[model samples]
Target: MTTQPHFFIEDSLLYAEEFFAGLGKITRFSGRTVTADDIKDADYLLTRSTTKVNEALLYKCTKLKFVGTATAGYNHIDADYLAERNIEWAPAAGCNADAVADYVISSGLNLANKYGFALKDKKIAIVGVGQIGKRLTKRFAALGCEVVQFDPVRAELESAFTSASFADVLACDFITCHVPYVKSGKHTTHHMFDKQTLLKLKPETILINACRGEVINNADLVEVLTAGHDLRVVLDVFENEPEIEMALLPLLEFGTPHIAGHSLEGKARGTEILYQILCQRLELPVEIKLQDLLPAMAVDHMVLTEKYQLSQRQFRALMNLVYDIRNDDVDFRLGLAKSPDSFDSLRRNYSIRRELTSLKIYCDDTLYPTFTNLGFNTSLIKGE
Candidate 1:
């Protein structure tokens, strides 16, 4: 008889159990409460950001042979240590690109509408041109927005690609960050935004950070905003999360827990990726498909009878039907009102968030591109 793989999985990862059916001995644990003692006997560890898979947690976990995080960022994983132990590691990067792109678009639209600036005419600087940034670039270009992308790593990797100058980035009307959390070196992203850097931003600049909280210095931001600086901000991640700086809340245009990549499809995709990786490692034929695991959406289809207007309000209204970013802000504030410990609670009980692909829109050729670019599933009206 073949030896069965012992697996430890985080329960919050969507569809993980369904994908791993008949594959191994499964043990599910809450990321918040899982301990090294809990996973000591496991042959594999699959987790999300909440579970810190470092030497501290894994030193005693000798039986583990594989480790994977169903998340875009692997900053929580000690890859060097895993490699030293000869344990393989991988992250489901780009799994949440569509979801995050949706968040950025919705947030940008809100800011544009509130600030009286047309999105198509605004200049946007996107820091970190990774999967999420690339999607935002394509979508923003389709919307007629001028986007300046900057990623030093990508610039070095791709000879044809040129990263934008930092000065040019700071000069834009809007600056959004989607970089990973890098703590050391020339390209370090931690505390990239300080009092000086924050002050350097253009007046009325809409600054958005969805990637990581330390990306923007929270305390420095509080200082900047308190000192009468003008920076309209929207932040999804924060420093010292689950215990955020309460003073920073009132200063933000919209503040949320780290849920930018929390779309149902995104989470499922991340899990599916890890499952596929395990399948590959085991040399098993891949039989699972993401589409098969998803449920029928509540608001799955719509038809546009008239010509679609591309105003920020109209664009934002259409997005609102699928997801209202403002509601999250309201819920975030209210959750904090009820209890400071509600940050993770809100995330754990995060409502069903379907991506734009879940909603199919039938529109004429004149309006098809916009909807599709914004991540909607669109079909042209045949007779139109």
Candidate 2:
């Protein structure tokens, strides 16, 4: 009889229980609470970004041969340690690109609505034009917003891609960061937006950071806000997660517990990628499809009649019906004051959020192509 490989996975992963049940004997644990002893005899370990996969946690896992992180960011994993042990590792990059872009568009529209301004009238500066940044550029461009990007590495490779200077980024109406966390190097992103950078920003410039908390110094951010700078900040990731600075909560226009990329489709895609990687490492044939694992969307279809036209505000409201970012904002705001653990708990128990592609919308012919380009499934409806 073939021995069933024992697999250890983080409990927060969506579809993990069902996806891995047939492949091996599975054990799930809280990512942050997992210890070295937990995977002592496990053949494989899978985790999200929350778990720190280092020598300290894996020193006792003598049987471990493969590890996978179901997240785009892998700063938590020590690559050199894994290389020394000859442990094969994979990270699910670009899996959450669309989901994050959806979050940015939703929140951007919300901000525009709240402040009574047209989205097309404002310029957005996107820092680090990687997977997520590229998606944001496409979506915002479709919506007629002026977008400027800053990514030195990508600029070197793609001549067609325009690269804006850091000084130019600071002058924009809104700034969003999507760079990975790099502690040191020529492209070190650690606290890239320090006190000096923050001070240079134009007053009332909206700042959004969903990339990593460390990219912006939280202390500097708090100091800048306290100084009565008219900046509006939206943070999905914080410098210190779970144990976030509570003082910054009241000042934010919107805040979430790092769920910007935790959409149902995104989570499923991450799981599927890791599943494929594990299968390849184990010499097992891949059998699962991502579509097979997804649940039916709670919202299936929407109708836009001739009586109502698709204005920016109306479009935002319609998008909210599919995936409203404010719900997450409210949850974090209410829970953050209660306890530190609430942040992690909120993410672990995040509500089911579907991507825009999951819902079909019936609208006028003029609006169908635009909505389709924005990743919405759309059908033409007669307009009066």
Candidate 3:
């Protein structure tokens, strides 16, 4: 009898244990706590961004032939080292694009509402126009915000998008970064927003960083904030990760533990992509569907009973019922304060978050098209 391959997966991957049960024997360890010896006998190793995959971790895994990261970013994995050893590796790129876009929209709209500024009157500068950046541009444009994109890489290929300079991006009312963590090269994103860059921003600018923590220097940011800069900052990713600078919390309009891409659909999509890749490599049938692994939605449908037409504020409130930034912000602040060392634990224990695609909204005709375009399942209610 041919023995089934053994797979070791990170504990944070949603539905991983259940998804891979029939395919092979599985063992799961905390992503950050995983050691080289833990995966020594495994044929496959699946990890998230927390665990670093390099020579040290793979040295003991003699039987390991395949490695996969269920994330769009592959900076944690040493692809060069894997290629040298003839180990096939796969990363789920653009898997969480929609999730991160949703985060930007939710937070942006919330800030606009709080500051009493119309989104249509604001200009948003997107630092990178990759999968997440494209989604953000589309959504913000649909909301009537003037979108400026800054991606030389994509601008060189696509004539439709005229790239803006770094100085031009800083002049916008809102600046959101979606660039990958590029350590070297002319377009390097490491400390892209350093002391000099941060100094260029106007006091009213709202800065958001969800791409990578190291892309923006936290120390410089803290110094700027401490000096009484009036910039509204929102950070989902940090430089040192779980060991985040607690002092920066008070200065931020919103803060979350790198969960902008942790939506249920996104996480499931990442796992499914890797599953398909692994099946092809092992010559096994790809029979799994991402939808099959998802549990029932916590909130399937919602009804809006408004006397008059639905305003943007009302729409935002209804959307918040589905997915609220404040919940994550509050949970992160409380959890982190109580347990400073439990940064990964906070992410691993994040509540079941669904994407906008998972929700159905019943609203007036005025709001039907907008909500539908925003990826919500919407039905026009005849009665106001």
Candidate 4:
């Protein structure tokens, strides 16, 4: 008799059940206690970064021999403890790199145009040179921007970048952080950019944080803004989700929900990679490709100049052209701030978002000239 592998999931991947059939008998659970119980009788368990997997939980899973997390961050897993127990662990590293890069580039370029400064020749200091950071460097460089990097953990990578110290990064014209959360390490990024550090930034510097919140103390940031610091703060992620200091709300240049890496293309890629890894570990052959898995969506060709004539709400009109996943997140975050207790509900019911690739644009005949002049694509929606 062939040994059957029982697969347990923690209700996070949010993928369709039909897509996961045949690999194993899959069971889904949301509550921690219930999920833990399921893990005890399963041979494999899958989870996201939000679920904490440590020794205590591992000890309860006597039948578990493999673990997989469908997220870029794996800090929740106690690797040292898992190693001693001979359990295999895998994470979807760099899965959302492109998605994040898209967010930064699109938002950055839009802001640049608004500020009257050409993106070309502007210098950027990116902290943390990991998968996402490296991808951002390439994207920014392609747009004719000078990129400097600072990642003490990866000194060897310095050869590819104009690397400098943390102080040097703070002084750059634009600074974006991509560091991970490390609680107890020489390079602990928790509250790394505090009030003292914020004061050092040039008055006109553009400060953007898309990494984990608390990486920069929100309280300190609020104080800096209140004290007349000339920082243009753009945040997609905050120290506390759905909670923003009322005083600081008016000071932010751009604030949105944590959708910087929530693109459908990115999420699907992550899921596909997780599927492959899980199959290999379980000794099953799984063939999954992102292109084959993604559902194509039609893109409407937007004539910026003509659309400019539509409504008086400039932001909303422009947003409608490319509006999808990220915009929904922005609304959800704002809603959460109004109703803090509804966070769980907001996350559970998040609408499925698609990448630009899923869209096919159709430009108006007369407005085609306007789209060409604005450098907007009139043919298709390409991935950034």
Q: Rate the local accuracy (lDDT) of all candidates.
A: 0.87, 0.87, 0.85, 0.69
Return the TM-score for candidate 1, rounded to 2 decimals: 0.92
Best-fitting candidate, measured by lDDT? 1
The TM-score that candidate 2 achieves is 0.88
> In model 3, where do residues sit more than 4 Å from their true spots?
1-3, 35-37, 157-161, 282-285, 303-309, 339-344, 362-369, 377-384
Better of 3 and 4 by lDDT: 3
In model 1, which range of ten residues has the least summed lDDT?
Answer: 306-315
**In candidate 2, what are the lDDT values of residues 1-384, reduced to their tens digit?**
999999899987778866777789999988878888887887889899789999999999988988899988888899999999999898998888888888988888999999999988889999999999988888888788899999987887998877998888998999999998889988889999988999999998989999899999999999999999889899999987878888888889999998899888998788888888877777888887887767777678887774354689887987787778888898888886677568888987888688987888888876776788677878887442
- The digit string of per-residue lDDT tens for model 3 on 168-251 reads 898999999999888999788999988898989998899999988998999999999899878999999999877888888888
Rank order by lDDT, top first? Answer: 1, 2, 3, 4
lDDT, candidate 4, 64-128, per-residue tens: 87888877878789999899989988998987876666566656666666677776557898888
Task: Give the runs in model 1 whose Cα sits over 4 Å from its true position.
Answer: 59-63, 306-310
Model 2, clash count?
0
